[model samples]
Target: MIREALRKLMEQAPLTREEARQVMTSIMEGQATPAQIGALLVALRMKGEAPEEVAGFAAAMREKATPVSCPEPERTVDIVGTGGDGKHTINISTLAALVVAGAGVPVAKHGNRSVSSKCGSADVLQALGVNLDLDARQLSRCLEAVGMAFLFAPKLHPAMKHAIGPRRELGVRTVFNILGPITNPAGVRRQLIGVFSRDLARLLARVLQQLGATHILLVHSDDGLDEISLAAPTYVVELKEGDIREYRIDARAFGLSPQPDGITGGDAETNAAIARRILEGEAHPAREVV
Candidate 1:
């Protein structure tokens, strides 16, 4: 099955939704060999992932994920980003999740450790003494208690274990990068997702719309940052009530100036301290970005 899929992909023929689903299911179920998995990932990337292909992969991932009950899922939102932006900016989305939760909104933050960046949400969270191994029930409780929960990807989507080695060995962005932000274990319908490529903004929005997302914002900065940029206009694809719209946003609109130099990140501990300063109401441009 994978060999045939690879051949089709090499021909630049997009997979039908069902075919992608089957391939991803097999991958998750440990049926595809590491070589096959690598080939599949590279093939899809080279072919330019179609919306149907991304939707299918996300559907299969959701089917295999360990579920966590979100408190009022319709009201809950997840803030995350595809991490291979290569900018290594401070964990903006992670900090945004905490800030949104603090503002009395229910949040289910889905994340993993650093895959392509120096520090991912889980890495920074772990640096801040937050436990990442919580089970589904415990995650639900955490959400109910503080209006926010961190859905660690490895813990919630154990099926991804099969592809971890190949994914690491390949060391390039693949379909899994797109899949992560869309496959929230808590099943929240509203989300704010940052994509590493502007081309992916509308593509991801369409994929989420096809996957039954109620409301979502897919963002990418013109300057190549995944998160909205202070340096340049950020492209936005907003999907709300089944309608998708595209727009660009600039920092000046919010009385903030472009301080691109302020956006920087180091190790987990470094980012953790930056997050703490923002949370503590320190006066910094990063605070404005967050």
Candidate 2:
């Protein structure tokens, strides 16, 4: 069945949600060989997953994820993004998580270290003194105390550890990049996700629906940055009350000035410093980057 599924995907034929779910299950359960995994992921990349396929992949990820519970008034939202921006912008979503949590909505932000860029979300947060080594219970407690939680990606999805070599070997963007956002361990009902590409926003919103997310904002910054960008038109795929809405968000609507400047850093240290000044709410490019 796995071989046939791989063959089908290789042929660029879209899988039904069930078929894709089984493939994801097989992959996550160690049921597929390295060669088979390579074939499956490559086939997926070549064909590109449809919304249904994305939905199935998200379902299997959520099913296998180690669950973490949020406290009372379960209206929690995850501010996470797939961070291979290669643009080295400061941690926008992480900063947004802070403000969103401050605004009374419970937040659980999933993040990882710098892979493609100078400083990823976790890098900047760690620089700011957020203990990245918290256990699951500690993670929950942190959320209850501050209305926010940050689940380090590898810690929450240990299964992905085995795929690190495979993903790194592939080197460029693969199916795994998108999975990071869809597998938030917090089990929140709503989220704000930023995809690296505009085309991915719509596809991810559909997958979010299949994964049981009730309310979500899938976003792409028009200037190729993820998250909401002030300088460029923001592309969005919003899920509300079971309906999918796609539109552009200009900063003028929020009464904020728009400025998307070139964000280029030599390394993580440089980027982390930028994030520090921004989180301090000081005047800098990092503020706009957020």
Candidate 3:
């Protein structure tokens, strides 16, 4: 059955929502071999995933993920970016998550270790003394105590381990890449998601809309930075109250200068330092990017 589905996907036919869900279920249940999983992922990437397929896959992941609850789900927000942007920026979204939390917004930040960059959200957070191995209860405590919690993707979605080896071996972006941002374990209704591509930005907005997301900002920069870019105009698709609006935002609109030269942190330690400087108002570029 899986082979026939893969053949159809390879033939450029999109999967029905049910077929996509079944495929992901098989992969997560360890029923699909590594070779079969790799082939299916590559085929889907090549053929381009439909929004239905992406939504179905995300539904399966959310079903399998360990849910973390907060006292106020509606008041909580998540800030995350699809990590394969290859920009190696100074972990802007993670910093933004911190700032948002500091301003008293409950934040359930979801992320993993580095995929295409020297530092990911988990990596930098760990460097800054965050314990990433908290259980669901501990995570809830963190949120209640500090107005923020980091839902490490691997910890929340243990079923993903079945595909990790295959995903690393394949070493390319798949539907799973986009799925991560949409599948917040805390099930946050409000989010700011940065995608590596403009197409992904539009597609994710639609997926979030279908998933009943209340307020979401899907952003992609013209220069390829995932988060709202200071270097270039950012294309934004906002999903609010079931209506989707597409627009572009420039840094100058916010009274900030365009920073075409990107910021870089060579490692997690450096990224942590950069984040601290931004928080302390010592780094202008890093502060502006956030």
Question: What TM-score would you give candidate 3 relative to the actual structure?
Answer: 0.96
Off by over 4 Å in 1: none
The candidate with the higher TM-score, 1 or 2, is 1
Q: How accurate locally, in lDDT, is each candidate?
A: 0.91, 0.79, 0.88
**Which model is ahead, 2 or 3, in terms of lDDT?**
3
Write model 2 residue lDDT over 188-286, tens digit each, in one string: 768888888877887887777767678889888777877787777889999886789999988767866765563555455666676666667789755
TM-score of each model, in listed order:
0.97, 0.92, 0.96
Q: For residues 119-179, what per-residue lDDT tens digits would candidate 1 score against the true structure?
A: 9999999999999999999999998999999999999999989999999899888888888
RMSD of each: 1.1, 2.0, 1.3
Ranking by TM-score: 1, 3, 2
lDDT for model 2 comes to 0.79
Error of 1 at 286 (Å): 0.9
